[model samples]
Target chain A: MKISILRKKLDDKEISAVELTRLYLDRISAADKLTDAYLYVNYDGAIKAAQSAQTIIDAKQSRPFTGIPIALKDNLCTFDMPTTCSSKMLDGFVPPYDATVVAKLRGQGAVFLGKLNMDEFAMGASTKTSYYKKTKNPYDLTRVPGGSSGGSAAAVSVGLCAAALGSDTGGSIRQPASFCGITGHRPTYGFVSRSGCIAFASSLDQIGPLADTADDCAALLTATAGRDIYDQTTADKTFDLKKSDKGIKGKRFGLIKELMGKEVDKDVSAAVKKAAEWFINAGAVVEEVSLPMLTHAVPIYYLISSAEAASNLAKFDGVRYGFRPEKTLNFFDMISKSRDEGFGWEVKRRIMLGSYALCSGYYDDYYKRAIKLCGIIKSQYAEAFKKYDALLSPVAPTTAYPFDKLPDDPAQMYLADICTVSAALAGLPSLSTPCGYDKDGMPIGLMITGKRFDDAAVLSAAGAYEKEFVRKPPQLKGVSEMKL
Target chain B: MKSDISIKWLGNLSKIKFDDDGLKKMAADMQSIMTLMDSLLLVEPVEFEDGTEFCGLDALRADTVRDSFDPELLVSQAKDSKDGCFVIPKIL
Candidate 1:
C-alpha cells in the first residue's frame, strides 16, 4: 500500500495503526520464512511503537509517515534493537543511540517493522555473504534479491512493509531494488544524515529509501533528508516532495553510452531503450552521452571503499565491544583471534585487501591513485550534467541472477556493479524504477541520475517515467495480498 | 603482465600463513588485478586538488568530562574481564 493512501485510510478510520502494524507483522511471519528478509523482527517493540502511533492518530496528530510501517536495513543503528549488519561481529551490539534517520522516522511516527538482513557490514553485492542466511528474491525464490540492501528491497517488494530505509554504498540500494523489481532512491551523498550509521566507506555511503513506487520514495526522502548538526555532511537545502505533475517536457537526458554498450544483457538494454522511447514520446529530448571515465569506476571504488572499510572495521576488536576470542596467548593474539572469529569470509577478505592498500609502502601507489580516479569519475558526471538535466542508464548489467549461478570468482562478482558505480563515486542522486520485464520474467530497471543535491528533479523524472512507461509487476500467485 | 610479489612479504604483513602454492595463486591473482589497474596510468590525470576534500572526520574542541560509555557494557562481551577492564595476555 502507498503511504499517501495509507494516510487517507487512517484519517478516515478505515484502518488503525495497530491493525496495520499487526497485518504487516502477520505478513512478515508468513512471508519472511520464505524470503529470509529480516535478520531480527522486533515483535514486542514494533507493537509498542505501533500502539504509540495509534495514540497519535487518535489525537489527530497527522504527519507524513505517521502510522506507516517501514523496514530498516540492519546496518542502520537503532537504540532499542540490536543493530547487527548481518554479521556475527556485531551480533548483539545494541547501539546506545538511534541513527539520525531512525530518530527522524520515529519522530514522524513511522512504525518500525523490523531490522532487515544485509551483506555483512555492507561489503558484498550479494546478501549470500551475510552471516545470516541469504535473502531470497520475492519474485522467484531461487534468485538473489541483490545487496547489501537485499532484505530491504525484498521486504518492500513482497509487501512485508510499505517502504524501507537502505544504505547505498556502491549500488547496495539501487542494485537490490532493480533485482527485486521495486523503486529505490540513493539521494545525493550527504542529503540524508549518516550520524549513528555504522561506518563502512564513510565518504561513499548514503542512506536512501526502497519503496514499491517512485512517489513513495519521494515522500520517504522528504522525511529522512536534510542537514543534521551531528552529520555535518548533510545538505542544508529543503526538498519539497509533494506530487508534481511536471512531466519531463523539454528536459535534456543523456543515455550514458558506456552503460548502453554490447556488454549489457540484451533484455536489460531493450527495457531501458523502451523507457528512453517513452521519455522521447513525452516530449523530452533523449541523446546518447559518453562517459568513458566510467570504465575505471569499479576498480577505483573498490580501492577507496576497501581502504576506508579496513579502518572503520578496526574498532570491532574484542576489547571495547562486539565478539571476543575464547582464548588468547597475548593481547595481540586476542585482537587477532577476536577479529578472525567474528568476521565472515567476505569481511575478512576486504579487511585484508584494505589493510594491504593502506599499508606503508603501498599507500601512495594504491589508495592515493584510487582517490585521484574518484575525482575523475566525479568530474565526468559534473561535465555531463552541465549539458543534461539527468543521465539515464541501466541499474545493473543484467536482471536478477539465479542464486546458485552467481560466479564464484570475486572479479566476476565485481563486474555486476559495472553501470552503477559512477553515480556512487560522483555522490549524485540516483534512482532505479522497474521499467520492464525480460523474456525470462526478471525485471529490468532504468536508473535515473541527477546532479548533486538535485534529488527532487531526479525523483520527479522517475515519477514521470513511472507514470508514462512502467507497468507494475503482476502479483505472484499463492502470496497472500494485502489491501489498504 | 601480472607480477607475483613474494608471498612471504604478504604473509608477514597480514599475519596469515600461506603455503608456497597458496602464495603463488594469491600473488598471481593480485598481480593480474594490479596490472589492470596499471591501465589507469595512461588515462589523463584528473586535477585532484580541485574537488578533493576530507570528509566525516573533524577536529573538534576536546571535552575533558564528556559522557563515557558504561564501563560494564564495554567488557560485557569480553571472554575475560576483571575490575573494570578486560584482561589480556602478554604482547611483548
Candidate 2:
C-alpha cells in the first residue's frame, strides 16, 4: 500500500497504526524467507513505536510519517539496531546514535520495521557480496536484486515495508530499484545528510528512498533532506515537493544517446524509447542528445570511488567496535587478521584496487586522471542541462540477471553501471522509475536525471510519467497488497 | 600487468593476506578488473576546468564546546573495553 492512502486510513481510525505494523510484520515473516530482504526485524520495537504513533494520532499531533512502517538499508545507523553494512566487519555492532535521516524519521513518528541488507560495505553491483545472505529479486527468486541497496529495493518491491532508505554511491539504489520494478531516487549530492551512514565512497554516497512511486520517494526526502552541522557537505538547500503540482507540460527531456545505443539490450532500449514517446505526447519535447564523456563513466567511477573508499574505510581496525581475530601476533597482525576474517572477497578486492590507485607512483596516473575525466563528464552534463530540463535513459544495460552469472569476471558487472554513475560523478539528481518490462516479464527502469539541486523537477518529471504508467508489483506467492 | 600490479604487493598495502588458493583467485579477479582499468589509458591528459572553489577554514563551523557521548557509552561499544577505554594489543 502507498503511504498516501495509508495516511488517510490511519487518520480515519479505520485501522490503527499497531494493526498496520502487525500486518507488515506478518507479511515480512511470510515473504522475506524467499527474498532475504531484511537483515534484522525489530518486532517488539516496531509495535512499541506504533503504540506511541497511535497516541500521537489520538492527540492530533501526527507528523508526515507518523505511524508509517519503514525499513532502513543496514548502513544507516540506528542506535537500537545493528548497523552492519551487511558485512561481518561490524557484525553485532549497534551505533550509539541514529543517522541524521533516521533521527529525522524517528522525530516524525515513523515506525522502524528493521534494517535491510546490502552489498558488503556497499562494494558490489549485486547483493551476492553480502556476508549474511544474498537478496533475491522479488520478481524472480533466482535472479539477483541489484545492489548495494538490494534489500531496500526488494523489501519495498514486495511490500515488506511502505518504503526503505538506501544509499547510492554508484547506482546502488537506482539499479536495484530498476531490477525490482520500484521507484528510487538518488538525491543530488549534498542534498541529504550522511552523518551516520557507514561511509562507502564518501564523495559519491547520498542516502535516498526506494518506494512504490516517485511521489512517495519525494515525501521521504522532504522529511530527511537539509543541512546538518555534523555533516558540513550537506547543501543549505530545500525542495518543495508538491505532489499535486507535478506536470510535464512544456518541459524538455533529452534521451541520452549513449545509454539507449546498440550496447543496451533491445528490450531495455525499447522501453526507454517508449517512455520518450510518452513524454513527447504529454506536451514535453524529447530529443536525442550525446554526452560522449559518458563512455568513460564506469572507469572514472571505479577509480575515484575506490580511492575515496580506501581512505574512508581505514578506521575499521578491529580494536574498537567490530570483529577481532581469535589469535594474533601483535598490533599490526591483529588488525590485518581481523580485517581479513571480517570482510568478504568483494570488499577485499575493492580495498586492494583502491590502495593500488592511491599508491605514490600511481596516484597521478590513475586517481588524478580519473578526477580530471570526472570533471569533463560534469561539464558535458552541465552543457546538456542547458538545453534540456531532464535527461532520460535506461537504468541499467539490462534487467536483473541470475546469480553466479559473473563468477569469473567481476569487471563485467561493474561495466554495466555505465548508465547511472555519470549522475553520481556530477552530483546530479537522478531517479529510476519503472517504464516497462522485457520479454521475460522482468522490469526495465527509465532513469530520469536533472541538474544538481534540481531534484524537485526531476521527481516531478518521474511523477508525471508514473501517472501514465501503471506499475506492476511482484507476483511472488506470499506477496499481497494490504486490503485497507 | 599482473606482475607489475602484484596481488601480494597490493595485499600488503591493504593489510590483507591471502593463502595460495585465495592468491590465485585474487590474481585472476584483479587481472580481469585491470583489463577494465586499462580503458583509463584512452582518456586524454587534459585538465578540464572544474568550478569547485576551495571552502577553506571559513567553511568549518564555530568550534563551540558541546556535549559528546559519554566515555562509558562510547567505550561500551568496543569489542574489548575496560575502565572506559578500549583494550588493544600492547605496542612495543
Candidate 3:
C-alpha cells in the first residue's frame, strides 16, 4: 500500500503499528535469503519503535510516518543497528549517533526495518562489488538488482518494506530502481543533509528514496530533507510535500539526444520514445536536446568520485574504528595489511586510481582536468534548462543484465551509468519512474531530471506521467504477491 | 598510457599491497580507464562555481566549543582500546 493509504488505515485503527511491523518483519525473514535485501534485521528495535508509535496512535497524536516501516540503506549511521555499507572494512561497526536523516525519521515515530544492503561504500553500478551478499532483481531472480542501492530498491519492489532510503552518486538509486521496477528519487544536492552517512564521494553523493510510487518517494523525501546544522552543505529551504500537477499541458520536455543512442537496448529506447509521445499527446512540446558534454560525464565522474573516495576512505586504517587485522606488526604495516584484506577489489582499484590522480606530477593532468570537464558538463545542462522544464532519458542503456554475465574489466561496467551521471554532475533533482518493460520483461525506467533544487516540480511532473500513462510492470512474485 | 611502475607507486601511495597478479589487473584496469578519460580532453577550460552562500564552505559554522561523542562511546567502536586511547601497534 502507498504511504498515505497506510497512514489512513493506522489513523482509523484498522491495524496497529505492532501488527504492521510484524507483518513486514515476517516477509523480510521469508525472502531476504533470495533478495539479500537487508544486511541486518532490527526485529527487537522495530518492535520497540512500533510500540511507541502505538502509544502515540492511541492518544490520537500521530505524524504522517508514525507507524511506517522504512528500509534504510546500510551506509547511514544508526546508533542501535549496524551500518556496514555492505563492506567488510567496517564490519559490525555501529555509530554512537544517528545520521541527521535517521534522527528526523525517528522523531516522526517511523519504525526501523533494519539496514538494507548496498555496494560497499556506495561504489559501483552493480551489487556484485558488495563485500556481502549479491542482491537479485525482484523482477527476475537470475539478474542483479542494480547498485549501489540494489537491496533498497529490491526491498521496495517486492513489498519487503513500504519505502527505502538509498544514497546515489552517479545513479545508484535510479539505476537500481529501474532494474527492480520501482520509483527512486535523488533530490537536489545540498537539499538533503548528508551528515553521519558514511562518505563515498562527498560532493556527488546524495541520499534518496525508493518506493512503490512517486508520491511515496515525495513523502519520504519530505521526511529526510531540509536544513541540518551538522551538514553545512544543506539548504535551508523546506521540501513542499504538496504535489501540484500542471499535467503535460504546455510542459516543455527535452528528450536528451545523447541518451537515446542506438547503443541503448531496443525496448529501452522504445519506452523512452513512448514517454515522449505521451507528452506530445498531452499538448506538450518535445524536442531532441543535444548536450555534447554528456559523453565526458562518465570519466569525469569516475575520476572525481574516486579521488574523493580515496581521501574519505583513508580513515579506515584499522586503529581508529572497525575491523582490524589480528596479526602483530608495526602501526603502518598493520594498517596496510588490514586495508588490503578489508576492502574488496573494486574499492581498492578506485583508491589506487584516486591516489594516482591526486599524486604529484599527475594532479593537473587528471584530477584538475576532470573537475574542469565537470564544470563544462554542468554548463551544458544549465544551457539545456533554459529551453526545457526537464530532460528525459532511459535510466540505463539496458535493463538488468544476467547475474552470471559479469564483466572482467571495471571500465566495462562503468558504461552502465552512461545515461544517469550528467544530472548528478550538475547536482540536479533526478528520478527514475518505471515506464514500461523490455522484450525480456525487465522494467525500463524513464529518467526525468529538472533544474537544481527543483525537486518538487521534478517529482510532481513524473507523478503526473504515471497518472496519464498507466504503464505498469508485470505482477511481482513472493511477498508482493501476498495481498496486504 | 598507465605505466606499471607508476601504478606500483600508486599502490604505495594508496597503502594497499598487491600480489603480482593483483598488480597486473590493477595496471590493466587503470590503463583502460585512463584511455576512456581521454574523452574529457575535448572540453574547453571551465571554472568550478562555488555554491550559494548558504551551501558553500563559507557557510560552515564558526569554530567553537561544542558537545562531542562521549569518550566511552567513541572508544567503544575501536577494536582494541584502553584508558581512553585506541591500542595500535608500536610506533617507537
Candidate 4:
C-alpha cells in the first residue's frame, strides 16, 4: 500500500502502528524471497519502534510520518542495525549513531523496516556486484532490479514497505525506480542532508525517495529534506509538500534530443513520446531541445565519479571499523588482503580506475579536464532551463534486462548510464514515473527534470502526467505472473 | 602519452596490482576513450568566471560538531579494539 493509504488507515484507527509493521513484515516474508530486497530486517527494533508509535497514536499525538513503515538503503548508517552497503567490507560494522536522515525519519515516528540492499558502496548500476544476493526486479524475478538503489526500489515496488530512502549519485535511485516501474525522486543537491551516508562521490550524492506514486515520494522528500547542522551542504530552503495541481498550462518543456537517439530502446522512446503528448494535451508546450554536451555525459560522469570514488574508498583499509584480514604478515599485506577479500570485482575496478585518473602526471589530463567538462555541462543545463520550465526524457534506454544477459565489456555496462547522467552532473531535481510497458510487459519510465532547487515544479509536472497518462501498469501482478 | 609513465607507476600509486596483460588492455581502452572525449576541445572558449557555477564551498560553514557521542562507542564497533582505540596493522 502507498504511504497516503497507510496514513489514512492509521488516522481512522483501523490499523495500529504495530499491526501495520507486522503486516509489512509478513508481506516481506512472503514476497522478498523472490525479490531479495533487504540486506537486514531489524525485526526487534522495528517492533519496539512500532509499539512506541502505537503509544503515541493511542495518545493522539500524530506526526507527519507517524507509523509509516520505510526501508533504508544499506549505505545509510543506522544506529541500531547493520549498514552493510551489500558488501563484506562492512559486514559487521555497525555505527553507534544514526545517519542524520535516519534520525529525522525516526523523530517523525516512522517504523524502520530494515536496511535494504544496494550496489557495494553504491558503486554499480546493477546490484549484481553486491556481496549479498542480487536484488531481483519486482516486475520480473529473472531480471535485475537496477542499482545502486536496487533494493530500495524493489521493496517499495513489491509492497514490502510503504516507501524507501535511496541515495542517487548517478541515477542510483531514478534508474532503479524506472526499472521497477515506480516513482523515484532525486531532490536537488543539498535538498536532503548526507551527513551519515557512506560516501560515493561527496559532491554528487543526494538521498531521495522511492514510492508507489509521485505524491508519496513528495511527502517523504518533504519529511527528509532541509538544513542540518551536521550536514553543512544541505539547503536552507524548505520544499512545499502539499500537492498542488498546477495544470501544465503554457509551461515550456524541452524534450532533450540527445536522450532520444537510436540507442534508446523503441518502447522507451514510445513511452517518452506518450508522456510528451500527455503534457501537450494538458496545455503545456513541448519542443525538442539540444544538449550537445549530453553526448559526452556518460564518459565525463564515469571519469569524475571514479576519481571521487578512489578518494572516498581509501578509508576502507584493514583498520578502524570495517573488515580486517587475519593474515597480517605485513601492513601492506593486511591492507591488500582485506580489500581483495572484502570488495567485489566491480568495486575494485572503479577504485583502481579512479586512483589512476587522480594520480600525479595524469591528474591534469584526465581528472582536471573531467571537472572542467562537468562545469561546461552544468552551464549547458542552465542555458536549457532558461528556455524551458523543465526537461523530459526516457529514464533508461530500456526496461529491466535479464540477469545474465548484460554485456561482458565494462564500457558496455557504463553505457547503461547514458540517459540519466546529465541531471546528476547539474545536481538538479528529477523524477521517474511509469509511462507505459514494452511488448514483454516490462514497464518503461518517463524522466522529468527541473532547474536546480525547482523540485516542486518537477514533482508537479510528474504528478500532472501521472494523473493524465492513460498507460499505467495494471494492478499489482506479483513476480510469479511475469513471463520471465 | 608519456613513455616514462608505465602501468607499474600507475599501479603503485593506486595501491593495486594488475597482470601485464591487464595493464596493456586497460591502457589501450582508456586511450581510445580519452581520444573520443577530445571532441570537447572544439567548443568555443568562454571566460570560466562568467559561467554559472555550482554554489561554491564558500557557502559552507565552518565545521562545528553538532552532536558528540562517546568515542568509546565508536571504538566498540571496530573489529580490533584495544585501550579504547581502533587497532590496525603497523604500517611503519
What are the per-residue Cα lDDT tens digits for candidate 3 across A1-484?
A: 6898889889999999999999999989887877888889999999999999999999999998998998899999999998888889989898999999999999999998899888888988778788888888877888989999998988988888889999999999999999998899999999889998899999888998998889999888888888788888888777765744455579788999998998799999998899889878878899999998787788888889899999999999988897788884788888888888999988998898788778887788789998887777887888888899989999999999898886886777887789998888888999999889988888899999998887876788788787766655435454456445
Query: After best superposition, candidate 2 residue A223: deviation in angstroms?
Result: 0.3
Alpha-carbon lDDT of model 2? 0.90
- Please, what are the lDDT tens digits per residue for candidate 1 over residues A1-484? 7888998998788988889889999989887888999988988888898889888889999798888999999999998888989989888888877999999999988899889999999988779889979899887888899999999999998899989999999999999999999999999887799988888998889999999888999898889888687777776656776643365889999999999888899999988998999999888999999988898787788888888988888787777678876767877767766776788767765665676778776777778888877887877787888899999999999888898898866666776798888888888889999998888788889999998877877898888877766555535456777876
- What docking grade applies to model 3? medium
Report, in order, each candidate's fnat: 0.25, 0.66, 0.70, 0.34
Where in model 2 is the C-alpha error above 4 Å? A243-246, B52-58
lDDT of 4 at B85: 86
Q: Model 2, A369-428: lDDT tens per residue?
A: 898898999888888988998999999998999996755577887889999999999988
Q: Tens digit of lDDT per residue, candidate 4, span A1-484?
A: 6677778788789888998888888777777887899989878888999999888888888787988899999999998898888889999778887898899989989999999999999988778888988888866788889989999998888778889999999999999999988899999998898989999988899999998888888888888888887777777777775654465799999999999999999989987998899888889999999998788888788878888988888888767778786766777877766776777767766776687678777776767777887888888888898899999999999899998997767777887898888899889999999889898888898999998888888898888777766544333444332110
Model 4: DockQ vs. true structure = 0.42
Please list all clashing residue pairs in model 4, or write none if there are none.
none
TM-score of each: 0.93, 0.97, 0.97, 0.93
Ten-residue segment with the worst summed lDDT in candidate 2 chain A? A237-246
Model 1 chain A: weakest 10-residue lDDT segment is A469-478
Residue B14's lDDT within candidate 2 is 89
Cα deviation of A356, candidate 4, in Å: 1.7
In angstroms, how far off is A73's CA in candidate 2? 0.3
lDDT of 1: 0.83
Candidate order (TM-score): 2, 3, 4, 1
Ranking by DockQ: 2, 3, 4, 1
